[model samples]
Target: MQTFRTEIENPVVEKDIIDLANKIELFHKGKIDEEKFRSLRLARGVYGQRQEGVQMIRIKLPYGKVKSNQLRRVSDVSDEYSRGRLHITTRQDIQIHYVDLNRTPELWAELEKDDVTLREACGNTVRNITASELAGIDINEPFDVSPYADAMFRFFLRNPICQEMGRKFKVSFSSSDDDTGLSYMHDLGFIAKIENGVRGFKVMIGGGLGSQPREADVLYDFIPTDKIIPTMEGVVRVFDRYGERKSRAKARMKFLIKDVGLDAFIELVEAEQNAIELKTVAIDADVYPVSKPVSVEAPQVAIKDQKAFELWKSTNLIPQKQDGYVAIGIKVLLGDFYTDKARLLADLVEKYAAGEIRLSLRQNIVIPFVKEDLVPFFYTELEKLGLVEVGYNKAVDITACPGTDTCNLGIASSTGIADELERVLKAEYPQYLTKDDLVIKISGCMNACGQHNMANIGFQGMSVRTPDKLVAPALQVLLGGENLKNGKGAFADKVVKVPSKRGPEALRRILNDFEANANGKTFYEYYQVTGERYFYDLLNDLQDVTNLTQDDFIDWGTNEEYVKEIGVGECAGVVIDLIATLFFESEEKIENATVSFDNKVYSSAIYHAYSSMVNSAKALLIAENKSTNTHAGIISQFDELFVESGKINLGVSFSELIYQINKNAPTEAFASKYIESANLFLDKVRTYRSPKPLKGAK
Candidate 1:
């Protein structure tokens, strides 16, 4: 494990990997708390799997862009550390599961050699920044949003402000007004626009999906490109300070904005402007690397089935703004593919295409910069790898998470049901293969990892009980959700609950009714006309549990009797309230502050110092059994209990000392003074907590 230290070139990343290794050793030795260790590893993209004694590693791919070499690197790592399988996530990240926990640091180091990262892919940090897979090549886009998305991903990867927030933050950039990125469901969303020849974005803030889904509110109709980074920094600072800590359920940014109102949230964000480092960060799109397609003569290939080839082209070929070139979309089944197929696809693109592939938000793959004449050859090559499935982004293409397969929070089997549903779509409802207006998504639980709440037709896993106290896997059917484009969307309404065995029947009835009465209306329009009660009535008969057979007790893709087993979810991470751990974390924050100050990152240094003081105060407050729900609450309570009582005297009140972050601009002088004050405050707090000798006693 120590060999990784010399192999890694970047000192910061090397330190991170080394710290993870040391922490893992401490955890095994029972020195570090399990909750704290979970938080630490999750931020580094090492997640707990459903199976014991193993982990799932998520590889963060910004905007879903992966070079040919990077893909090959991921394949190699998956084969070495995991089970030689790669699972694409709805967030455009690739996850490999079933790896020993002790080997993660080395696995991460191997990935970094190819410029791939896992940092901030999970946990309570800014997650993978996703963009439209069609971003650069979309014909309808005013300009590509890829450069802006890339800049956002780079800026916050290890930023101080969002390192330890109440919950994770999500961001997206849409290619055009079509909202291909689904901006309305993210914490922060940007839509590309060019006003008066100046590039800018239409910004949306405070959106999220889970048990309760909230559509994002528009923060700005138009903000220049230079303002996006600074505005995001301010927003993150506000979320970190005021976001909930005690209750994981209410910790998302959407909940805070809801509780405080959007106007008040905007005010808080505006107040953080002075502490932001760069008020105007100009992103140079010209400097972004553009992939060039290989120049080669078209290869003539014989089409085995002309009809099948035409149908595939109709649904899979994407129109590009660049003339004489097209993009290909490969519909991956249930987002699961093996390393053998991945390597072949990587080689295919590197030889004839742009040497790159973009993973879509729908858990598929997109190959860009292919010459129009080369489609036949590419299709033939992809067909041999079993990647030529029809209905790319259409209704037949379903989106699902690795629910009961690997997630600890799964209540039922999402992937199994998704597989059966796709089979039904192909065998019975063949027309859906050409229909791109409808979407279907499933989730193992209410966390909405598969984005179930935002799909036109959605299913959420659950369990139902009968009169005899027998439990069976069930699904909640939701209807009437759709993205209206340009930062507008709706959440699906829960209509009915049915046994897992009856899921296929529910879908059959719903589709039969829609095909009979929809009459040229989109699924959303048809649902609105029919209403929720109509669908509830249509599938209500499937809810009868009185006559459930033995088959109903078994979840899809499994022969054993289903047991409703759900483990504690680590998506938002756990609250660390241990006094010793809190003090240790405070000292660590001071160290980070000093390092940032040395690196000349004034804003980052100031925030780190602020965090150190807040953490130290929270440590003492926890000792006193006081409330520490928010940073502001900690500061005010510390003043009342400790400062007013004169237990430990700082020159000024705690709030007065800490509030300088928002009051003063982030400069070298303030950063140096703030760090010094934080260190001094830590020393004072330590002395106050220490046992003192009696009067005249040494």
Candidate 2:
């Protein structure tokens, strides 16, 4: 383990890995609180799997861009640390399961060698910043959004402001109006737009997909590219200050914007402008290194089946803006691929294409910069690796999460049923291999990890009881959702709940009805016309649980009777308010303030000091069982309970003391005063809490 510490070049990253190792040791020795430890590990990208005792490591890949060297490195790490399998996530992250908890530090250290990271890949921090897979090469895009996405990802990788917000915040960059990145469902979404000969983006804020989906509101019709980073900073600061924290279910930015009108939220965001670190952080769109295809003569290869080759070429190849080059889409089954094929693919890309790959939002892979003339050679090589699948984003292509396979929140086997559905689609509807309009997604639960709520046809894992008091696996069938292009989309409507075994039948009935009476209209168009009630009436009989047989008791991909068990979900943001932890955090914040002050970042220093005071007050408030839902709430509550009640003397209202941060300009004098004030405030809170006995004090 010390060897890993010595191997890391960056001292900060080395410290992070060492700290994680120490924390894991403490946790294993029963020297740390389990819940608190879970939060620490989760923020580092180590997640608890459903199988227990093993971990799922999420490798953060910014905007799904992976160079061949990085892919080879990841494949090597996966083979050494876990099984030789990598699962691409809906957020364009790569995850490896069944990893020993102790090896995570080494695993993360190994990834850093290739400039890949696992930091902020999970937990309450900003997750991987995703963008359209074809961001750089999209012909319709106003400009490439890859560099902007990369800049944001870099800015917030270890930024303290969003390290522990009310909940996780998701951001996305769409290449064009097509919204291929699914901007409508993210917390903050940016669509590329050119306004008045300037590179800008159509900004959307406060949208999210979960148990409750909310469409984002238009924050700005267009904002200059230089301003997006600063605007995002203000939005995050506002959410951290005013967003919900007590109730995990309602803690997202969407709920906050919904509760307080978007106008009020905008006002709060605007108020954060003065405190932002950078007013205009410029990202040169060309920062993303352009790659040229390796010069390789077209290899002579014979197509075994001409019709199969034609089908694959027509459906899987996407034309790139670059003349004479094409992007090949590989339909990854359930986003799972083995290390053997991965290394081979990496070799293929490095030898012939641009030495890189883009993981699609559809949980597939796109190999760009492949010459059209070399398509036959590439296809033959891919065929050997089993990477030549016909359906890229077609009807036969389905998106699903790990579900009961690994995720703790999984209620049913999403992968199992997705496998079955894909099987049925290939076997029964061969024509769908080229049909790209329909989307079918599955989630083991309502978390929408599979984006089920935004799919043309969706299935949510659930359970139902029979008349005999026997519980069986079930799925809530949803329909009529699609991306309407240009940042607009619809959420699916739950039409019926049926046994898991009957999911195929429900799909059969829906497709049969659609084909018979659709009158040449698209799936979404027909769904919009017929409405939810019509679909419900058609599939209503399948919801009957009384007619279940013995097989219904068993879930798909299992040989034994189904037992519904859901573990604690890690996506719920965590907070700790132990007196010691609070004091420790305040000290760390003071150190951060000092560092910022030394670096001449007065605004950052002032905010860090302000956060320290709020954290110290929050410690006392939690001691008194006061609500700490938001930073604003904490300030007011601290004033009401501590200052006014004379329990702790600050000589003035806590609000007045802390609110000075916003009232005064951030200067050398204010930074000094604020740092002193935060120090005194933390000391006072500690003194007041020292004599009091807390119920769960460790």
Query: lDDT (CA) for every model shown?
Result: 0.92, 0.89
Clashes of 1: 0
TM accuracy, model 1: 0.98
Per-candidate RMSD vs. true structure? 2.4, 2.0
Worst 10 residues of 2 by lDDT: 689-698
Best by lDDT: 1
Candidate 2 residue lDDT tens string, 125-234: 89999999998888888888888999899888777778778889999999999999888888999999998899999989888888899888999899999999889988
lDDT of 1 by residue, 348-432 (tens): 9999999999999999999999999999999999999999899999999999988898999999999999999999999999999
Model 2 residue 230 lDDT score: 88
